[model samples]
Target: MRMVKVEASVSLRRDLDTGTEMQRDAVDNIITQVIEQGDHALYTLTKTLDGAELDQLRVTEAEMEAAYAQMDEELIGALREAMTNIRDFHQRQLRQSWLTTKEDGTILGQQITALDSVGVYVPGGKAAYPSSIMMNVIPAQVAGVKRIVMVSPPQADGSLPAGVLVTASELGVEEIYKVGGAQAVAALAYGTESITPVDKITGPGNIYVALAKRAVFGKVDIDMIAGPSEIVVLADETGDPGYIAADLLSQAEHDERASAVLVTTSNELAEQVSVEVEKQLALLPRKDIAAASIRDYGVIYVARDIAEAIHVVNELAPEHLELLTKEPMNLVGKIRHAGAIFVGSYSSEPVGDYFAGPNHVLPTNGTARFSSPLNVDDFIKKSSIIAYSKEALEANGSKISALARLEGLEAHARAIDIRLEGNK
Candidate 1:
């Protein structure tokens, strides 16, 4: 990991601008082709990028059943437990339509409705993310989404991952497709013969997937254009170097583009952590990927004090912020931007990523400054409802007509005029 002196101007905006513009253009091309060519384009892109021959794009019932039967009892039990916790967390976020009436018989309320259908994209091939299956589907399920369709790239044998199938089945997601990447996104955005278009698509994926989601934003709602996984640890003298090193590596191992940074007031702890990272990197199976991530994006910044460290953290707006100081809670109030805050040494990033109740699918590339983590709220819409009795209309009609006329909307004024005339 590189040691950089913490600068006052360093902020999340700086980090957001790090990716190459050429990558963005390449992603745009995928989106253009997917939109124009539809299913045929999806198949061609899949074969070219995934290096997998494709015949059928959707998963069969037999495969789902076989996957359920193949899974071990222990693994099934664990998935069931995680599902329950996730369900409970999201269930608390569910809201109902409400109405209120006044003495004049005026009624107003907000009607909360779940989405009709949703699509979840899970990465396949070398990266089979069953955790993503749980994170994306559970909220939609909790929000009462009627149809939850899933898309993933198929294996060379054109088979869905057993773990993915098992997870989807457990979550009651009946519609699973084997298509993935930008093409699968296209299929979800616009209906193909084999796949139904969804109201919204949510999940994490490669740059192509992110760019595809950006392209199809108006066509379908997306959670966010998530970038690589990231973690920023704010520690003090009391924080453990070993624990800090372990937490940093947890995110770095995700991918070569992933970032793990440390901002500390103590230089002694920084040196200890720098050494500990090297020692721990040797034991990791993904050492090469983690090392590359560390070499490129990782940093240890020595701050003048904890306040400066906190300032830097807020500016960064990291996806996962770990506060490892003596009084983590005291600093919590100071944190203005972060996808999720892990308060103490025990509250590591992985805990939230896997077993913890909070959603792991979070805003990346400093998007936490304005965006949010995926939640049950993402799957529901709110509609405002208003009704007025004749007496109530008589009371407010003049003001309504005046305001509408002032805005040069004569039709709106005429509508109110008609109501008033009926009352007279």
Candidate 2:
């Protein structure tokens, strides 16, 4: 990490402009094939990419039970604890159908309903994230999603990761599939012979999986098209370099494309954090990946003041924003963009990613400017409710018809016109 003191305008543009067209095109191609050819295309792609030969894609009950028995008690307990916290948080986000009636006999409100079935795609191969399983499934369960189906690729031994299986079992997810990548996405998007098509799909994977979700968006509802994870640390002279360095590396270790940026007012803190990152990188198991991420996408910008740092963060609209200033709370009102905000030194990004009672599936690559973190709202739909008595319609029908005719929607006008004439 190199430390460079630049004005806020330049730093903002540079950080916000990190977009990749090549990656988008690659993901689009995979989605097109999955939609065009369906299961046959999925099978060929899975074999070519995952290097696994599969006769069946869905994981049997026998496999899930074996996975539960294989795991140690201590790890199982930890997963359960994480699930409890996640469930408790998402439970608060649940919305019930509501209605309101006016004195004139006009009734209006919204009916909130959970999806009948939802699919959660867990990454397979070296990236077996059980944390992701808990994050994706718990919210849907809280929102009363009828059935939750999970999918991940198999290991070389043809078994799913112990943690993945254990988490699924703990969360009451019986529909686990061995399929992965764009093919698994296809199975979830369009019902295959074995796997049942879900009403919606939510989870994270590589570019292929993301593209598949984008392609099948209309066919089945999906969570956001997630890009690489990123973290922006806004610190001052009071911030600890060690803590800042660790938090930045936490996201960088996710992938080579993952970004970690430190924007600070103090030159000394910036330089100290750079050294701390180097020292900490040497101790991490995924040092090569972290190092590559830091070398390519990581940046440390020294601003003239704390206000400048905040300005840069707002423009970038980072997925994760960590405020490590002397008074982190004071800066809360200043933030207008960020999928999730972590205040103070103790509130690190990982806390929310795992144990904290908040959704970790956040918007990435500057999408936070317009998007939000996943929550119960993502798993449910809202329909507006409207009812009007004859008197209420008689009072407002002519205005409605006038507005409709002004827009040249004669049918809409006549619909109201018919109601008014009938009442008269």
Candidate 3:
């Protein structure tokens, strides 16, 4: 970590951008092949891209049973506990189809309906992310979505990770597939003989997965396009230098592009955290990766006060934010942006990533300014309810026509006119 003095009029969000070629050509080529060749393309691409040849695309019932049976009781208990927490949290976010009546006999409300099906993409690259299975599947399950299909790259042995498979099975995700990358996304977006097309897709992945999700948008709903993992810690004089350094490294080790920034009011704390980060980074197994991330993108901004630190935090809109000041709760109301806020040193960012009830699939790359963490809402659709009584239509028909005609849409105005005539 390097210390940088926050200057007036200087933008702190300069690094908050992803210009990866969108892997557009490769994504387009892969998606085209999947649409053109169906299951064969999935099979061929798995071997070509992931270097794992798979005779089976779907995880078999036997595989699910084996994964469960092989897992130790401790892991099973931990996963179940985490799943329960996630399920309980999302259940609070579940909405019901509502209809409110009016004296005018005009019924207007929203009908909340679960999507028919959804696909969850779990990355199976260097490590197994069993937490992704819980975070992605539980919300859809809580939203009353009928079908949830899960896809992930296979291990080197061409089998689904036991942790991922067992977790998915425990959470009632019955349709698990052993396919990944842009090809898997194509099969989910547009249907194949083996895998059915879904109404929406959710989860994070590599650049190819992100590009594929972008390509398939409008064709199939997708969660926001995720960029590299990032975390920005906001601290004041009372903050712990050790806690700050360890927390930032948690995200830095995820990828070389992943960013870890510390914005503090005290220059002394900034230097202390930089030294602490180096001391901790030396002992990490992924030190090289974290070092590259810290060397290339890591930064510590010295602010004049808590207000200036908060300003930098809002402008950057980091994926994860930690408030290590004496008054984290008070400052939260002033924050306009940030995907997730971990108050105090006790509320570490990974708490939400795993066992905490909140969804870990959050917006990144300054998107937290507008987007939200994944929730049950992502798995459901809403239809505006409108049942106009004859009296109500008569009361508003002329006004509706005037507004429509003002927009030069005669047909829109005529639509109301025809309905008025029909009632007459």
- For each of the candidates, the C-alpha root-mean-square deviation to the true structure, in angstroms, is 2.4, 2.7, 2.0
Candidate 1 scores a C-alpha RMSD against the true structure in Å of 2.4
Q: Pick the candidate with the highest lDDT.
A: 3
Error of 2 at 146 (Å): 0.4
Candidate 2, residues 1-424, lDDT tens digits: the string is: 8566664332222243222687656656666666677667666666777787777666778887888788999988877888888889989888889999998999999999889999999998966698999999999999989899998988766678888888888888888878787778878887766677899999998766777787789999999878778899999899999999999999989888788999999988988999999999999999999999899888998888877888889988999999999899999999999999999999999899888879999988788888988999999999999988888888888899999999999999999898788766
Where model 2 places Cα greater than 4 Å from the true spot, the runs are 8-45
lDDT pick, better of 1 and 2: 1
Which 10-residue span in candidate 1 carries the lowest summed lDDT?
Answer: 10-19
**Which regions of candidate 3 fall more than 4 Å away from where they truly are?**
8-22, 418-424
For TM-score, the strongest prediction is 3
Q: All candidates' TM-scores?
A: 0.92, 0.92, 0.95
For each candidate, the alpha-carbon lDDT, in order, equals 0.87, 0.85, 0.89
**Residue 225's C-alpha lDDT in candidate 3?**
81
lDDT by residue (1-424, candidate 3, tens digit) is 6677866432224353333654678889999999999999999999988888888898888888888788999989998999999999999998888898788899999999999999999999667899988888899989988899999999777888788888888887888888999998999999899998999998888878888888899999998887778899999989999999999999999989888999999988998999999999999999999999999879999998888889899999988999999889999998899999999989999999999889999888888999999999998889999998888989999999999999999999999999899888
CA shift of 292, model 2, Å = 1.8
